[model samples]
Target: MRTDDVLEVMNELVAFVRVAEAGSFSAAARQHGQTPSAVSRQVARLEKVMGVALLQRSTRQLRLTEAGLDVLERGREMVAAAQATVRVAEGHVGVPRGRVRISAPKAFARQVLQQPLLSFLQRCPEVDLHLMVVDRPVDALREGVDLVIRLTDDPPPGMVARALMPVRQLLLASPAYLSGRPPVRTPEDLMAHSCLSLGEQERDNRWRWVRGGDVVEVAVSGRYTVNHSEMRLAAVEAGLGVGCVPDFVARDALAAGRVVQLLPDWVFDNHYQGTAYLLFAASRHTAPKVRALIDHLVAALGPCAQPV
Candidate 1:
């Protein structure tokens, strides 16, 4: 085949795969800067070339046939390979440009990462960022994200995880709450106090404390149990109860003397204790935009981590 012929075929395959992944030609068209009719024609041309029906279309929805499913499964890899090839070539010849999509939990992104991301964009003039704040771990490939910032001890399989920082949660109480109460000297001391905690996990009600290689779980009850870390912090600030909260969330309050760290020698562990990592496809490591963002994250946030 001629060079143009190969390029044409690849383009058609890219279009078809995008439509399959998006579940609608219109969505694919919007993503790729094409009209739905044009995208539909590309898929039609690809089907003709392959001599098979690739999709079953109706007014309300689009479904893939067996042949279409086969094409989609294989074609996605080809599209990725092609994108990687382009990124590699761009890495060699040009400054990092184009949009970099990132997926992260909303509260964390807003509370901690927002300012840093803005600082990064200010420094890197050629780079554009698309931030998606999601509560759950998103499929990077399916979501078309360049990176995912996740708080996890074990990252998902088949991705490169660079630990940006170790997350530390500490037991804390407002100075007001601690003023008249008996001093907490040990794990057992917490038994007499109301402990605000996360309600989502069984482990939340059963608080874990670590001190000098000794770990203990205490079954504690609370007047308030919340799913959000900030809420727990709020309850603690209001002198409701002692709560487990990350250092980042409590740092400002601690500095301001609004809240004091309880059991200073003991470390509190929660569901996301291990680390915050920047995850990406291994193939995209050489992409300059990915490298730039990772560098910024490491430089800005890594040093702030409290020692584990």
Candidate 2:
């Protein structure tokens, strides 16, 4: 085949892959600035050239055939390799200029990401930063986000991830609440106090504490319970009860003497406190825009540094 023929075939494969990824021919058309019929024709031509049916089409949905599934997996790799090649060639010659979209939780976005991102924006004038702050799970790749910063013990599977920081959970109570209340010198003493419950409706009111090879589990009850970190912090600050909170969330209050740590030596064993990971698609690690932001975040936020 001629060079032009090879390029045409590659374009067709890309069109097919985009349609599959977008989940609709119309969506791919909108992305590529082409009509749906044109994109469909491109896929049809590729099917004819390869002598196999790729997609089973209906009015409501499009499903990939077995051949389409195999083609898509390989085609994405080829497209990524091509993109990486372009990025490498351009990086040596041009400045980093592109939009980098990031998905993060609402609370983390407001509290943690805002300052670092502001610094990153100042440093990279050519780059446009897009933040998608949601309280629920996000489909990073499908939604076209370039990176994600999430608090989890385990990062999402099949992605390149770096542990940026370890989140620490500690029990806390406002100084006002602690005053005239039973002294919480030990984990066992928590039973006599008003404990803030997380997921009070779903689980038993049991709190776990660990300190230097010693583990203790105590069953405690509370008047107020909430699922959100900020809410728990608010209730604790209002002198409602003793609540468990991430160190980052309670840092300002602790320092301001608004809330006091209950057990300084003990750590909460709940899954809420773990590590914050910087995650991105494995293929786009070398891209200039993505690489610059990842490097900046790791540097400013102190990668793998646990909160004191």
Candidate 2 vs. true structure, TM-score: 0.67
Please write out the lDDT profile of model 2 over residues 1-308, one tens digit for every residue.
35575467998999999999999999999998999999999999989878889999999999999999999999999999999998767863457677889988777777788999999998989889999998666777889888887788877888788777778887889888888878998889999999888773454478888989999999998899787788999999998999987778888988998888878888888766688777887773366877888888888776564322
* Candidate 1 Cα outliers beyond 4 Å, as residue runs: 1-93, 303-308
lDDT of each: 0.83, 0.85
Candidate 2 residue spans exceeding 4 A from truth: 1-93, 303-308
Candidate 1's clash total is 0
Local distance difference test, candidate 1: 0.83
Per-residue error for 54 in candidate 1, Å, reads 36
Residue pairs of candidate 1 with colliding backbone atoms: none
How much is 305 displaced in model 1, in angstroms? 11
